[model samples]
Target: MAATVTPENPRTSPTISRSVTHTVNGSHKFVIQGYSLAKGMGVGKHIASDLFAVGGYHWAIYFYPDGKNPEDNSTYVSVFIALANDGSDVRALFELTLVDQSGHGKHKVHSHFDRSLESGPYTLKYKGSMWGYKRFFRRSLLESSDFLKNDCLKINCTVGVVVSAIENLQLHSINVTESDIGSHFGALLDNMEGSDVTFNVAGEKFPAHKLVLAARSPEFRSKFFDGLDVEQQEIIVTDLDTKVFKALLHFIYRDTLTEEVDEVSSTTSSDFLISETLTAKLLAAADKYGLERLRMMCESRLCKDICVNSVSIILTLADSCHATELKSVCLKFAAENLAAVMMSEGFESMKENCPRLQSEILMTIAGCEVDSCSAGEKSQSVWAQLSDGGDDAE
Candidate 1:
């Protein structure tokens, strides 16, 4: 028989071991641990990083250095732990820690649980960083290494932790750190950097079209281009002075386009406005290239500085772009202020303006007169009916 028990030392790591016990009648019994895993701590590294495997449970144990609740730090930071299976229908365990730049572990808030671990065939859901654990524990654990990546999820593990989770748990596969994400980002940056990238983009050779397009734009030429064809060289020089073209070329080559506002145009306007335009253009380019942050910035500017003149433009633009929330707000505002809008000096010029509202005072007078007229009509109808009945009696 085998039995597991906990010790008084809360800090000392707990282990559950089993050994076969033989009885006098050739019967056998197993002893089990009575201790419960601390709340939020789960048994088994039931998740795989890559390759779906059968009969695996995805499991994650989050760690926090300062003991902050996972919900509080959901925005800027997260701690996630994926558990791999270690066979034998037993709980899996791993050492966890939080470290600073100096590589010293933060021990004060570190916590662990002593609980029975087991893995079985199950499905797990992977969601946001923190919510991953809450939704599909097993799936979240397996997929998290890929899902968390550079945005927020933070943690690292030795290869053993990964291998065990994959091999023993029968999990689909193991995820790499930033697990699957950093490499893609690095690849994109690699494409941006050209030969300057130490790593390749998406594990493939850089495409030339992006470089050429970046070279052609006024804002990006300084940052993205280096060597140009004779035709491009001549065209750039003709449209832009050699000095400006040279600056553009420098930006293209370095991929570092930094410029100040130039003291409100005291300096070259090209250096100021051109660079800002380039920044906006590059953001657009990034969005086109599927850069998440660039797209976010483009979208974030919509609700800012909303005004009468701009609101109409924004409304139309948002509608064309299918921005439902923005369109709803604009429509509501238009409905509420439509009356005042029609009274403005330029209201007559707008095709949508209502001219009938100008006669509101006359309409009130007509309404009163109509009530008097309607009263006379009702009396005539009644007299006609009464006269018909009297004639019949006669």
Candidate 2:
């Protein structure tokens, strides 16, 4: 059984014609029942009404008479569609879905359908239907007959079906504005949230592991985090935690935080000292993954808070791994404060243990000159010599 569209004016007959016109995205725009679904319309609740807008068309109708009763083997789905039409064209679109039944409720029956596309418009034709579908669809036409005063067709389908079909449909056109970036970002971000291997950082879910893996190579980062959540979506812009993570995550994403400072505050203390080893690991992992921002952070703590004492192990590890930036800072401190370093036995031992650092320090010490001559004595000596010369002349 096929559903049909009802005309507002009884004097005219119902007709649904579609035209595939070029839109912004280089694809066809399907004008179905005077309303458009862009291209690639999917079977879902959103387009239910539009699907039924064609004259003499019904939706979700299924007929299966296995030599049995009509009601037992026939079904129809309820759907409704409304179009904002202004005399000659449709301005907006909306749809409502009702139900899905495949005649035999005892055995779960699934119905598969397709949309037929042509040069101008598209047609959605269902393969199966029963008498119940015919009656249900016919009632929708009657209900929509007087909806609008414009003498156009009104669609009535049931509400609440999956809208998976129209999601990929795009228009044919050139999108050069930020709207293109924003829309694509929104869709990609939405898909990121849908993945399973992500984490809830603060409140937003992101691919925590993938972010760690993406460090070192930005190409790898882009590829690894390609389908993952973006900083803008999950990370709040104003919240301190989100802001901090945003800056850090971008570094992780792009591998470009070479000279950037990690904004640390009292809040950072909570995570590093009390919470999970995440902060520490992130720092080390950042260093390992070549995240300059994270490495700088570790370096800052290692330099400023010598009282932490345990940071030596980190410095040693970083130096052992040939963290050039970190090693330079450590070498500078040791060379400038050689006296204090020698007295502290720990730093002295560290210096002795590192041959490269020891060699650097020896070079710096050898080049430094210690002048013992006093300025006053040299002046007095010159005066005495002049006075002796005057006495000899007299």
Candidate 3:
């Protein structure tokens, strides 16, 4: 039965919004062994590990094998995390781990989270403040543990940094127009009316701008503008075919491959989508011209299309071009599919032409077999089989 009340003004109670903040974590792993470990065994002898940049600050792991103090020597091992870069008081959470590699699954980990106290993460002030356990572990116990393998130990450190950032909220509607700079460049490439130089590739002419070519490639720059007599209006490229040259020029101008690559061949299976032959040729040309990004693109494409029929040829190309990542991928694939790959015609060609590649492949296969084989009798049996195969190949 009561009297009604009026609502407050909407303008007086306006909604307010602020930005969000988040944390980022970075981790680094360092392995110390051999003579380095012996040198770090003295009291007060601390070695600064290799510097790793994480969370905008340079950080390092400090190891004191015999402890940092005279009293703790022979009883405990000391380890610390140090900030190598200059900064104000920075707050971070850190974890130091000694990996266990002896069949057992026991790994020793120490971190700021281990403490049950209500206090927050450790705050490092200035550049040199250290945050770690002075008595990390007992020396005798660690020496006998799986953490120490072959007189070497692996230490992994992860740092979690808390940062404050603001992201503004849009309170008003806005309209934006997207720019099409790439399409404009594509148009410029297609309309090559004022081209200054021409490349004759396999009886076909490809007109290009001298400044544009020079801007994209150092090799082109050297060939055109580096010397007075070296400058030429027409250059002959006899090594590459017309199609490969066209694709290369397209990448130089448009930063992309031609659309024909998307079209599938009617003869081959759907799995064989891209032309491996064309990609291999392009990779060689890109390597020859020092186009690193283009070469990487070609390598990545070849890596994805690897199969039993293509592994041998891809391995040969990868080795010739010194494409490390692609070579590793090809080797692993060949090793896993060893019996089937060796039966292919491409494998025979690789064996006859590239003897060094054959040796590398055999060694890689041996390594793979050893990793999967258990220790003792089974490991020796696997090694014997690998040896027999190598002798037969020779």
Which candidate should be chosen as best, given lDDT against the real structure?
3
Model 2, stretches more than 4 Å misplaced?
A: 1-283, 306-317, 348-355, 367-394
Worst 10 residues of 2 by lDDT: 23-32
The stretch of ten residues in a row with the least summed lDDT in candidate 1 is 23-32
Name the 10 consecutive residues with the lowest summed lDDT in model 3.
Answer: 264-273
Model 1 residue runs over 4 Å out of place are 1-296, 340-394
For each candidate, the alpha-carbon lDDT, in order, equals 0.33, 0.37, 0.75
Better of 1 and 2 by TM-score: 2
Local lDDT at 359 for model 2: 48
- TM-score for all models, in order of appearance: 0.23, 0.27, 0.50
Clashes of each: 30, 35, 0
Candidate 3 residue 288 Cα shift, in angstroms, is 1.1
How would you order the candidates by lDDT, starting with the best? Answer: 3, 2, 1
Tens-digit lDDT string for candidate 3 (1-394) = 9545557523343455676645568988877665234654678787678688878998999988778788645577778999998989887888998888696868889977555256677889899888887788888888888888888888889887767777566567588877666566667778876888888987778888888878888888877788662557788898888888898898888787776544323225432223346777888888887788888888887786677777787788888876778988888888777778887777897888886566566667556432333433454455478668778994
| Candidate 1 residue-wise lDDT, 1-394, digit = tens | 7445557534544444344322111111111111112222333212222211222433344442222334443222233444333333322232233222223443212222221134322222232122122222222342243323232322332111111222233325576654544354335544554433221233333223344445335333443454444223212122333333223333333333335202212123232132233333443344333334433343344444233333344344444444555545544544444444334333343223433222321223233332353644544454365447668894
- Model 2, 167-277: lDDT tens digits are 333344475754344344334434554432443456754543444445444644675577455442233223235434444555553443424343334213232231122
RMSD of each: 25.0, 33.1, 16.6
